[model samples]
Target: MDVIVIGGGIVGVATAYQLRAAGHRVCVVERHATVAQGATYGHGGIVLPTPLDAWFGPTFLGSRRGIVYRPGLNSSARRFAKQIAPLQAPDAFRAQWQRLRPLVELSRDAIASIEAGFHLEFEQREGVLHVTRDPREWEQAQSALELLGEFEMLHNVLSAAECAEVERSVPADPAFAGGVMFPQERTANCPLFTKLVKQVLDEQGGVQFLFGRAVESIRLENQRAAVELAPAESERKSTREVDVVSCDAIVVAAGAGSKPLLERLGLSLPFHPIRMLSLTSPIAYEECTPHLTVVDSVRRVSMTRMNQRIRVAGAAVLQPEREFAKPLSESLLEAGTALLAQSTHDWIPGAAKISAAHAWEGMRLLSPDGLPVVGNALHPRLFVNVGHGPAGWGLACGSAKVVSDLISGTPPSVPPDTLAALRVERFAS
Candidate 1:
């Protein structure tokens, strides 16, 4: 089989690697010079199934309220609601979650497989700390724990002492009623892990990476497809005809870029661009430093250990992509620091951490229904594997395998009903 993967992000890279390993001659067309230069470069690096209830499940109503009322506190909820609004209504995150949970689960399993395959080490530290200053939020977490049922597959509800023990940097604040520790989940070095996998893909026998090639257009013709490529490196411009490079199938792994292709095909996507932010500070071992991953419920800020450095990221905007919001992230960090001030004295102090901090803008390809599209497109010889939203890193592995199967006409590892929900046809009239 000859397959062309259209995107250089993790999802596309993973798909090319998988397809190549599966005996297909694969070529990747990336608009960027390097993999993960896009959205894959930012935060949310938890190789997770971390309390899936927050991102998906019954606890979302309050979560949504928490977002709109105090956007800083629960940024994801605000982002989720914002992204899901055009698809349904502003108050539609519950119904959206009903559509999203399965997709998140798929990402979880896929990421686990990827971790096992490459031994990709991305600053992986397990046991995230879910800290809350509000006692009521703690109670909410405890109740939501019951509602989660079997979905609490990898989490352990822990006492405050246990959380502090796992992360010595955390202060022993009594305001912290308790914590739900996702002991099995780990934070990753997103760039390092992505590059490692991409390196392997490049070394793979049948895979060819056309890096620095921005695809300008794609057209279906004579039962196949054609892609226009412009060199990203050469100052001299030239158009190359991909006619000589035939493909049995085309996988649209182009992240948010997949939107225009769908539109060009007269296909509509439940897809939107939701911006998420991350700020990284130097590796400070002060008593105020947060070492393990910690979640501040009200502020919607997430702190995770990224190698020698620590990153506090998690501000989602269900709005248009914006310029660097350094002030916003810094303020969120301050709020996070204040929340942590009560719980643990260990973390880089706010003033000390600012100079070393940098902000990034990244957008997730979101489906209106909160599910990923993972099947053939309305155009023949074309398929989709985009709109993964926040779970792209984790979902990359399973999604690639599923996309490979769809392209190869092979049976899937999961049930067909599961696959049906992800197909673009679901959005068709």
Candidate 2:
């Protein structure tokens, strides 16, 4: 089968890579002049399991006796506990737990395969220490932390002293009561990984990329799809009917743009645009920057050591599209730097100059229910593997494979509801 993947972000690139590997003649069309220039460019780069699944369960919806959805709050970890207080009935949270457990485990296993197959060398680390400033907050997470039990990563509850034992870089002071230590989580260079995948795809003969041109619309016929491509630099305004290619299958992995395409297909995809920020700073103190990832529950920031630097990122702002530019502003750069200064100072003691820190941003494509809609939607040939929310990077590898299986008409190992849940038809009725 010949397929055209409509976005060149991590998901699209990975999907194209898999499609070609599965013996499909594949062509990926990206709106940007370069690949991974969109949200794929500036992610936290952690290949994590899907942390929680609330889309189909009671906790995911706002019922008379139950409420879900909290905005402008700190870590989901903190709010996750409080929200379930209302849906305290038996097996209420269980429905969500059953749905989430498999996706999370699948995401982890998929990432491991990507790492092994490609010899993907990102500054991969094994532990994510989430330090909290309040004892009460840490206590709250204890009861609601049952969701993560499915993963092999040991979530060690620690006292401040015990936390200091694992990473001495952490402050032992009472500023924070304790932390949760995820001994198996890791982080990587997101931009570098995307580039490497594209490189590998180019080395093989079955794939092609059409960059710098934006897709204006698609033409669907006989259960097949074709897109009208407008050249980015051309002023003549002539559209090219995408080269002799019969788009046997179409995968819309265009991040937020996936919503608009859904509308064209008469399906309203419930999604929100959430903006996030990241800063890359040179490693000033080896002791301060742990070989592990760290999430400061107080500042709502996460720190992970990268190839040559440490990346500190966190902060979600959901506003109008015009208001959110999808990149850090001049004002945000100063505020974010100031926020990191204290944490870095506390963690990396006696550090020298911490320069070369740069800021970037990306808009997270969030669904009404947090889980991404993957597999087929609209036409059977029109597939979707997007809106994985903030966990896209962590879940990309498996999502790609699952998408490829759908394209090949093969029965996937993933549970059937995962596919059923992905259908836009579920939300239709």
Specify the highest-lDDT model's number: 2
lDDT of 1 by residue, 316-390 (tens): 544333322233455544543344332222322331254466666576766656668887886668888898766
> Cα lDDT of model 2 overall?
0.66
User: What TM-score do all the candidates reach, one by one?
Assistant: 0.81, 0.83
Candidate 2 lDDT by residue in tens digits, 67-135: 112233454423433443444332555554455455666667766766788787766667878776666
Point out the worst 10-residue segment of candidate 2 by lDDT: 60-69
TM-score attained by model 1: 0.81
